[model samples]
Every structure is written in C-alpha cells, then in structure tokens.
Target: MNHDKEPAKTGTKAGARGLPVLESETLFQGRNEIVIRHQGAEYRMKITRQGKLILNK
Candidate 1:
C-alpha cells in the first residue's frame, strides 16, 4: 500500500478548470462552521458528523 502524501500548494493560483483552490483547514480554522458573505447575502458552511461538507444559504 502506498502511504505517500502530496505536497500542499500554498501559491495563489487557479486550480483545476481555472477554479480557485483553497485549503479547508485554513478556512475553517479549527471550527466546523463558517459564514461566507457574497453579494450582500450570507451563507453557512459546515462539516457534518460524517465528515461531509455542506453549504447552506
């Protein structure tokens, strides 16, 4: 079995399909929920108990 881990990219650049890539650990900052404000609207991002991410408006 392979146990190698890929290096984390910390550069500011677009990832796959020209989309921006960000690290979740950095975004969450040890929290399970975060609020994102876009165009005067607020959205919530949370990690479920099963380790799945969910975004709600």
Candidate 2:
C-alpha cells in the first residue's frame, strides 16, 4: 500500500515536485499504452464502459 502523498489529477502518483513529466518509464514496445504509478503502486488502465479511463490498482 502507498502511504506517501495525495493522488494526482492523472489518478496516478505524479511523483514529487520537480520530477519528470513522463510517469511511466517502461512502455511495451509497439504499444502506445504504458503502465502508470498511482498513489504509490503501479497500474494499467483501459477505456471504461462509459468511454472514460479507469485505473485498477
């Protein structure tokens, strides 16, 4: 569990201030989607049934 800071607007752990903008460093080659870090854990999400992005931690 992540016991660090508040959740970022991106619904992911935007990391500390002054950090790089790119959240996910490792991306699956030939794939556009990349894993993201939320709160403190890692997760990958797909478009929701409502056409919205849903992240499952």
lDDT (Cα atoms) of all candidates against the true structure: 0.79, 0.50
Worst 10 residues of 1 by lDDT: 1-10
Model 1 stretches astray by more than 4 angstroms: 1-16
lDDT string for model 2 (1-57, tens) is 244744332334446764434332223333444467877888876554464556666
Best by lDDT: 1
Best by TM-score: 1
lDDT tens string, model 1, 12-39?
A: 6675666656788867778999998999
Model 1, position 56, has a per-residue lDDT of 98
TM-scores of all candidate predictions against the true structure: 0.68, 0.29
Q: What pairs collide in candidate 2?
A: 13-38
Worst 10 residues of 2 by lDDT: 22-31
